[model samples]
Target: MTSKLTLSVFTAPSRPVNGPPAIPAPQGGWTWPPTAATLIAGEREAILVDTVPTVEDSRKLADWIEASGKELTTIYITHGHIDHYLGSSTLVDRFPRARLVATEAVARDIKTEAESGNDRDFYGQMFVDELCSTVIEPEVLADHRLELEGHDVIAVATGQSDVKDSSYIHVPDLSAVIVGDIAYNDVHPTLIGSDHESRLAWIQTLSQIQDLKPSIVVAAHRRSDATNNAEVLADTIAYLQKVDRFLPGNRLQCSSLSR
Candidate 1:
């Protein structure tokens, strides 16, 4: 088999904001823009980490994958979030043989969200209008280890970062781990559907990833260069400590003052 597939990362052009531009804040360095996709190209198969939100963005990725001459074997949805999985349909259309792989919890969440009709509306309203454009269904519900193109793929349930079924994909050969939305770099982490235990779970997951000591760690929403397994573990621990100190009472007090 010819090794034609090439792993590439790209960032989407920033969305245009309509409001008057405010003066830049002083002192601190500017943060890097969020990366849209992280691709893994193989000799005969390719895998994508997360799909971008829009058809246009997904199509761009699809076109590049197609041009590379490697078949897209799977799209690894690290969780049930729209930003990571909504563009899956686009990939399906482009590569008929490609499978959508997610944890069982992620698949169940998609089904539940679809049946409730809130998956589109709620995520669309919160994230972007493009997220509402497609309906996603996972074809492969990964409960344990999966062997693909001579690669040992394991989807271990990390539990509670962005979604309940949130996970990390480990590729031992590459010494790489694709951690979706589990850690954010240089940005305030977003907490959703979280409880104290889940928050702790997120921290533990980070520690576990550090133990793996992957050469590269890919996060769903941060620049590709922003993280490695060790750095993510340290940064996430620090972030959680801060969250622990700022209690619900503090939030309530702040809300009261604003009103």
Candidate 2:
């Protein structure tokens, strides 16, 4: 008989940014908020959703995965965000057998980010010694579906959330969707670069996620202690909807929306 699947989340707490604030925040600088990686395990093997960013954080994540005593067979990246996949090299080193995979578009975006000098400077300046300088791009997933101990783990590419070619992981067995930046849980979302069209697209994406009827929704960035409540999907949609409606009238007021 096939073994039952178990899901667990490990979160790395927010850090104080070093560079100029992306938006107005406390004088101490904005806290980056926590990012979580979900591990889905069966009796013999496991699949990891995302890896934490920094070298230190990824090492800690590796230790946590090791503690599960399950062999990691796959590392699935939900999107191209550096914060989501920057420590991929560290994970790959720790789990040499685990293959890293992502959607074709996300793979391309990741490659682009890895090669971009501006991104290097930007993230390097923001994170300083805490960031992982090594970049590793995941292989393109052929069918957008992953197999974990006879279970199907589907990856759906949503057009945009906070970035282009974004996606989420849908594990039907657990009724869980690990949304990468598509939804925020009690944390300020990054929207400084977003426009009217993009916000509408984001709302549509959230609506699509809601349609899936996932009972457990995990936000990529959230409070470390927050629960994986499905309501965060609706909450994100409402936030985006409000941004769409009010952003035009008052730029300053809308800036605070992200806060």
Candidate 3:
């Protein structure tokens, strides 16, 4: 078996972002950190995992994939968050021959987010007009596996992480897993919907990934200063643990102070 498939990472580098009024802008202010997309390529074919949020970002990703010189077979979406698939229209249009596919649950969530206006209403300030006006639908995968150069790339349903119905990709031939937003490298994990109970679920999700024992863990969103390795999984687990400890108290303290 050929265990030498190549993997490349493309990050949509950060742009300046001013926190909304409630959050209040500090001295230097915040920046929207980069988003990641991965390409697992072989001699003749490839599989792309996830995508960036904006129209322009998707165009760049298309160009990057074109430069890889491998026929893009399928574009895999790991989960349902809009940002992960917002650029779908552009990608689909660009790669007309490539199929856009995801787990059934995730495909449903994409439709949910698109119709709910949650992504457009909140993320508009950061991405502005970059968000697409149309939705690019994806087909639900009949099986949890994607073939890259004829090797089986497995998709394991993690149940929940930052969002419900999240999953990570396991490439057994390469000893790697392309984890969506379940784990972060240096960047903070988003916990808006998280609480004590859901976080425990996330911890279990992390365990599911660890059980695979992958060496090269591909984080869906990452910072250049960080690394792609199993260690980041432990770090993400620790961050969620801290959130469980301090976040609630901090929220309560703020609530009390406001009152």
Instruction: For each of the candidates, give the backbone clash count.
Output: 0, 0, 0
**Which order, best to worst by lDDT?**
2, 3, 1
For each candidate, the alpha-carbon lDDT, in order, equals 0.64, 0.84, 0.79
Q: Which ten residues in a row have the lowest lDDT in candidate 1?
A: 250-259
Model 3: per-residue Cα lDDT at residue 127:
51
Each model's TM-score, in the order given?
0.79, 0.92, 0.90
Q: Where does candidate 1 stray beyond 4 Å?
A: 1-7, 13-35, 126-129, 193-195, 224-229, 248-259
What lDDT tens digits, residue by residue, belong to model 2 across residues 112-175? 9878855767877766447877778899998999988889889998898988679999999999
Find the 10 residues in a row with the least total lDDT in model 2.
Answer: 250-259
Pairs with backbone N, CA or C atoms under 3 Å apart (clashes), candidate 2? none
Model 3 lDDT tens row, 1-259: 5535888899887755545557665555556657899999888788899988877788989899998898888899999887788777787787788998888888888877767777777777655336665667688887888877568888777688888788888988879999998998888777765778788888889987888788999888798656799998899899888877876533222210010
Best by TM-score: 2
User: What are the C-alpha RMSDs, in order, of all predicted structures?
Assistant: 5.3, 2.5, 3.8
Instruction: Indicate the residue-level lDDT of 106 in model 1.
Output: 76
- Top lDDT: which candidate number? 2
